[model samples]
Target: MVDALLDIAGLRAGYESTTVLRDIDLRVEEGQLSVVIGPNGHGKTTLLRAISGLVTSSAGRITFAGQDITRMRPEAISARGLVHIPQGDALFPDMTVLENLTLGAFLRRGGRAERSQQLAVVYDIFPRLAERSSQRARTLSGGERRMLALGRGLMADARMLMIDEPSLGLAPVLVDEVYRQIARIAESGMTILLVEENFSRVRDLADRLTLIENGEVRASGTVQEVLADPAVAATYLGIES
Candidate 1:
């Protein structure tokens, strides 16, 4: 049986006095790529925030690595190897690429050599980052900045990476390139839970697809299963059965 690395049951959260997510149920299995696709403003980002402890859940339970972490502090959650890379490239504008990357390892416990080795691994996955290691993060192009954000997440030595809208605010070409690197990371055995607005981009990469609408799970299964559902096809895919 495949073990669920992250599980959410009936999770509800939102800004103060307003609920955005209601009865959200989802699970990401170990060593698999799970994709959550939905329209904008449908609580996709909010769900990720609740999982990462940036937004607290008002009800339900969140279990990570077999422990209940419904109310864990954000830093405490990060220490458990669950890393969240938000939608935009949240890098340090004045910091160099290398500086931003190293900061992701703050939760990691090790000496210089160990950190260096991990840095090498990330560099191998994203050569462009290595090439621009000395350049200020703000100077890099959109795609390069996304790569840096991902590289920083990997630097955390994350057991599972939660990325929100990686393709957001990028040119078509850059979106493809970013997804290619994401596939490379998944190929290297990184468990990823990715949020995307476009289903076509992730249809081939996702092991499982969960559809969220109005802050609740609308459909979830293997990619084929969800795509084949008549209601989902008609409403989300614009296909009539």
Candidate 2:
């Protein structure tokens, strides 16, 4: 956990009366890609939610950039450089792609020049977004929607990004494209925390990983170590534990 930008210790949270994340400990080192991979019903999405403050935490501490944010509001956490892109395309279906991306910086204290600078960077990351700047978000293809979502996160100037399922519904090629863009984003020096079901993609991109099943972390390690354990892989992947 050295150089850790986002740290969670003894984290426990869930919907009312239904515990989801239990004693979860995680770390995302600066400029690293940390992925959480598990099969359906393993609370991957819940973990992301818990980190973003969308779900209330019943216990534990969350520190981001050396500050505690265990009970902060979503907007508060976001402004402090933690951006969460939840599962599914949560775009403003009625708005243009450019409009959606612009909104990501609404909370930022930057002036016009800063806003322009960030927009240019976003276009560099996803030229497709630049091309469809005038197009409504709803009209975009699934892959394009994912791009916009990430682009929006970039505009937020997040120090650490929590992205849930970058390849949820795209074709194989598009999925690869999405994951590639994600990697590119990580390369830009911001830490990334991802929740993904595509085990292949996760293995290819993550610097480290944590396995969560039935609301608890089952394993945590480098890709080779975790994937080699039949019990660990099966417990989270739901094959044969």
Candidate 3:
């Protein structure tokens, strides 16, 4: 059996009085790239937020590496190596690129040399970050900022990385580059749970695909299986299968 690194069953969560996600069930296997694709306002971001403990689940459970983490605090969860790289590339605008990257290792338990080794790995993945290490985060271009955000997450040395819409707000060329980097990351055997608004962006990268519509799981399976589902073809692909 495949080892599931992150599993959610019957999950329900939302802000105050509004319920955004209902009975969502998903699984991301270890060392595989799982993609969740949905339209905007359909609870894609909310799903990630709830998993990372940014939003509390009203019901159901979230399990990571066989541990029940439904009620764990966000920081505590993050410290366990499940890192959430939120959409909008939430970097410290005033901080230098290097400083922001360094902050990602705050929860990591390691000596300086170990941290330096991780930083070197990130730089190797995103050479641009090393080139602009002294530059303020706010001054970098959108693509560069996205790279910094990814590099910062790598600094955490997460066992499972949950990324929210890595291609948001980027030109087509930049989107390609970002996805290329993501593919590279996956090639290195990192477990990734990636969210994307556009299905085309993740179609080739996903080892498994889950389609979410209006805060609920519509279909999930291997990429081909999900894409071949009749309902998915009609509603998502605009073609009747």
Candidate 4:
């Protein structure tokens, strides 16, 4: 995959002998908004953890930008432009929004000038963050917290963002806003591997769709290609085809 931003082959990851992801293989080409959707506890989060180096793979190959990162530390992997925003508010709740956003750029080798530039981009994307820069992360609403999380990732200057459940808990209006912002992020040229349960919200935004079940890739292709399968409907969506 000469142009792939991220690639995984024969990936196996687990926790203390309990394997969560088994023999998994996936790829996200440069500038594509690819999604992985499945039922709960089906290794969706584990897959993202593995790629982000939070969970180590027992046997596999993970390549990012043509570099082998199978055994790289989470920080090292992140430094190389792969940022993972885990599922939920993985932020310092007591910290101000500005503080959380600034911490995201800590791993970068660049100095304050570069960090400032990244912050500018994040604030541009989510002006709400700029407005509430001094407020604690815990004080924000659900949708505002999500926006802050995403803004923090942008502050890290991510080339590929592996985000888990951007719309986990929110009202219908907030979900729409979050999805709209996500679509804008993709439009702004970031390769995204999103794990979202709200398939309806992302169906139109994703360039490719992958269905993961029981630790394996059960289906993958263009959104239409994956969704049109009878197996996907019957197995994941509970719809008889």
Give candidate 1 regions above 4 Å deviation.
239-241
Q: What stretches of model 4 exceed 4 Å from their correct place?
A: 238-241
Candidate maximizing TM-score: 1
Candidate 1: RMSD to truth: 1.1
Per-prediction TM-score to the true structure, in the order listed: 0.97, 0.94, 0.97, 0.95
lDDT of 4 by residue, 104-208 (tens): 888876789999988888888898999999999999999999999998888885789988998887899998998889988999999999998767878789998
Write one digit per residue (lDDT tens) for candidate 1, span 1-241: 6669999999999999999999999999989999998889999999999999999899999999999988999999999999999989999999999999999998898888889999999999899999999999999999999999999999996899999999999999999999999999999999999999888899899999999999989999999899888989778866678
- Can you give the lDDT of residue 96 in candidate 3? 99
| C-alpha-based local distance difference test score of model 2 | 0.88
- The residue-by-residue lDDT of candidate 2 on 1-241, one tens digit each, is 2757988999999899999888999988888899988768878999888889999999999999999999999999999989999887899999999889889998877798998899999999899999999999999999999999999998996788899998887899999899888888888887899988867787777899888878888889898788789977675554454
lDDT score at residue 208, model 1, on the 0-100 scale: 95
Candidate 2 residue 59 Cα shift, in angstroms, is 0.7
Question: Which ranking of candidates, highest lDDT first?
Answer: 1, 3, 4, 2
Q: Can you write out model 3's per-residue Cα lDDT over 66-89, one digit (the tens) per residue?
A: 999999999999999999999988
**lDDT of candidate 4 vs native?**
0.90
- Where model 3 places Cα greater than 4 Å from the true spot, the runs are 238-241
Candidate 2 ranges with C-alpha deviation above 4 Å: 1-3, 233-241
> What ordering of candidates by TM-score runs from best to worst?
1, 3, 4, 2
